[model samples]
Target: MRSIWAATAMTVLLAAGAAACDSSSAGPAPAGGLAGSTASSSPSATPDLEAGEELARGLDVPWGLAFLPGGDALIAERDSGRILRLRPGGGTPEQVRTVPGVAARGEGGLLGIAVSPTFSSDNLVYAYLTADADNRIIRFRLDGGDPETVFDGIASAGFHNGGRIAFGPDGMLYAGTGDAGETSTSQDPASPNGKILRLTPEGKPAPGNPTTGSPVYSLGHRNVQGLAWDADGRLFATEFGQNELDEVNLIQPGRNYGWPEVEGDGDTAGGRYTGPLVTWPVREASPSGLAISGGTAYIAALRGERLWTLPLNGDTAGEPAARLQDRYGRLRTVQVAPDGALWLTTSNTDGRGDIREGDDRILRFPAR
Candidate 1:
């Protein structure tokens, strides 16, 4: 059950968000604004629940968007294995660096990126990518210096290769990995695949992990694509179900999520795993990058082609409301920017969707 305070906060947030969405200008954006870019969508158009503008377009399968201190965004391109930096004031993107040895196969490639917690001082950036033999993470200087592998040897197949990384409130790095199409790996305690892992910046296991000498924070995840945390430090992750269901789970340390044995809410008793906070049919939500803001969880949906806002009350989630349904094709990520806005990335150019001329864009909602 939700607390009174949480419910009240949720109400205020929804009202404010709705007001902002409705008060947008109906006039079209400037004619020359989208010139020289592959931008088919109108930046002036207001989606159902949000008014958004295209920040950048014509990207090559942009997987992750990490905002830097000065408001520059570093976007990771999956197939091209490049990290492009886009400044705030509308200049052409600069290719900051290309990841070495990325295997850009199906469902794998240069994936998630996280700027170092001390990026202002250290200039380090971390990336998770599929290499020749396995999935691995490399930390390197932002100035294109040599890299060092922090962790490696996770299974990387053609599909189900999970790749989402974030820094938790404790400043430790957390990663969500997939089962790599190997269901058994979800239950394998020793396998790095299909688990949420906590580690130090250097790739060693964090000190207070659920198990000593191991980075495995939780197991039994099939294909976790997103991770976020609420104000109470409660962790949440979005997952891909094999065929029928998609899930947003409240992640608890050491808890099993019942990968092959259970899908959605199981009626069978005594399962050795936790049920997801909410579930969706596969067609409605192939859940991806998630963000928590003002007591609501904003989830990016791929197959659903919308954004889902799930109100949060403590550990429980309210009914989800779909936003921008099919207005933008295949939303890939939802990130809360430093300026209290939401950054959305489209996945239309990723070969899985029908693309307009100006596809694969970064969109921004000034207020959420």
Candidate 2:
């Protein structure tokens, strides 16, 4: 086994031939990874965990992972504006659709994707992307059709274009938007950026929102990229902190999460703001995508180069455990497959990390 620091130091020198292996080839991964409780700030060696099977390779900045009705995966590329579909068993991914009007810039491009809950009837697929004018959510049919704009007017920038969308249990669309490098938008009620927007399938504000006739469900968020619901219908979101702490917040309608006012675990300003349930140093957890399975919340980390697991204890989150530390370069998106396996994607080719051969690949892990 190699030390995480050693692996990280040698990341740039990884052999091109090693990364050139196709998805059909099998490779041995580093063993004896490290684990620790993020809340306690302690790390220790854990058992030799399985490295999982590589599903596809040679991807270009894969960011989103959503499943079709038949269990096929639809992946969104952050820079290419292309959607690729892969089988559950692992093989070469086939291009399905190429989204138009994408303005790929710094950290901005095609981001998150979702399939309609009633795909059998409507066959609609939803996507959150950075368009030429703004960040927007669009829906199109996988069969064939021009993509229709479901919602628009969210701000976009080189960075902080929050682009994750999903459907809740109540059949409403939920989108997380970023502040677009403007600190004031996080606290502003009129701006859609830096807030969670809830809408109907037709792009109207859902009923029972915090404010009547407003799509804003929650406000005061910095840059939210991950959103998931627990078995009990609790919404958990992952937010990018400024320079110090990153956060995992339990979301509620119309709630204000301290942004410019505070970063993590700050003074709630006499209960006016809600604090995060868990916080980690930005280096340890630049968390991106989140998925909850069997009461455990799995977070995909980028700069940390690991997966963070947090157990759910009713309304509270337990200590987080790190997995695959430095085994892969940088993790971007994580999703629980329809058959209960964990699917993860690497972002080494995303321009910020060392580009290894065959980087930006997808891996499939066993069920939890």
Candidate 3:
């Protein structure tokens, strides 16, 4: 039965518009902005809930978020480059003063955050951001201390600078990067952009990396904005495809995923690239900031304005089912909190979208 099901699935994907090289095929593009970008949908009926209890509103374009050890949350604002500490009860946000050298530009800034595994003792906070010349990763003590540039020299562009970071179960730092809007760079081995990078905590290359002394873990990614590991330690990632295909992939070290070459799943003989476990039309899914828990990968959709739940069995990813569709204006980030609930942030303030005053909010949902 499993073999028959796999064969049927393969046949269906082959018939769909999968490859980028197919002249007759065109992928889904976002409505008003770039080819794969999306616009805001109409607002849904507001739910009747207690104010300031489940959600903490009044955030100014919050981008990345990390949970502190003491049940507090630290969030970063994209435009202002400020990191705010959100207290449990949620009054005024306390600003952390030590962040330095953030180049806030198109889809760039302090983009992703992760607390150190030893943060209780080390007080270290790591951020992936765009600098004046390039996209880099930096680590700093949370108590208003000078930052140390751990890894430098990743690619950067006005868009597609893929700035999501997380500490993997191996105690190594993993970063997702974009192709910097250059199609060719996604397939290039030497370029850091359009790749998944693995590095040591101090910014050195991990010992078991596929490339010797190089941080490239996986290649041929357009813009990877989310990374998560399952309970079995299998890695999964969400990527923004160029025009039509947005992908959820079971990431493997040193594997090439077809980007400009092959968009989704079709002919593998075209190259040695791996196919996505699941693909969605780009208009329906510009996936970012994914979190995995209880055998499901929860993905935050930017242009799609939805939360996608993809069931996972080991390293294999099933079809993505949409949740909260058209309910949130523009969902930017989704994370699993320490308390096991899913926390989501809206991207209504992203400048490209229709800005609803006070529309940007952090919402928490019970984990299913």
- Which model is ahead, 2 or 3, in terms of TM-score? 2
Once fitted onto the true fold, the runs of candidate 2 whose alpha carbons sit more than 4 angstroms away are 1-51
Per-residue lDDT of 1-368 in model 1, one digit per residue for the tens? Answer: 11312343345345433211121211111111132432222323322245577766667778988888887787888887777777554444556677779999998998899989899999989999999999998898886567899999999999888899988999999998999988999889899999999999999999988899999999989998899998899999999998899999999999998888888878534757799999999999999989887788999999999999999999899999998898988998888766656778899867788786567777777652
- Expressed as tens digits, the lDDT of each residue in 24-62 for candidate 2 is 212222111111110111112111227477777667789
Which stretch of 10 consecutive residues in model 3 shows the poorest summed lDDT? Answer: 29-38
Residue 106 of model 1: what lDDT? 92
lDDT of each: 0.81, 0.82, 0.75
Q: What local lDDT does model 2 show for residue 133? A: 86
Error of 2 at 353 (Å): 0.8
Candidate 1, residue 353: lDDT: 82
Ranking by lDDT: 2, 1, 3
Which of 1 and 2 is the better model by lDDT?
2
> Clashing residue pairs in candidate 2, if any?
none
Error of 3 at 290 (Å): 0.1
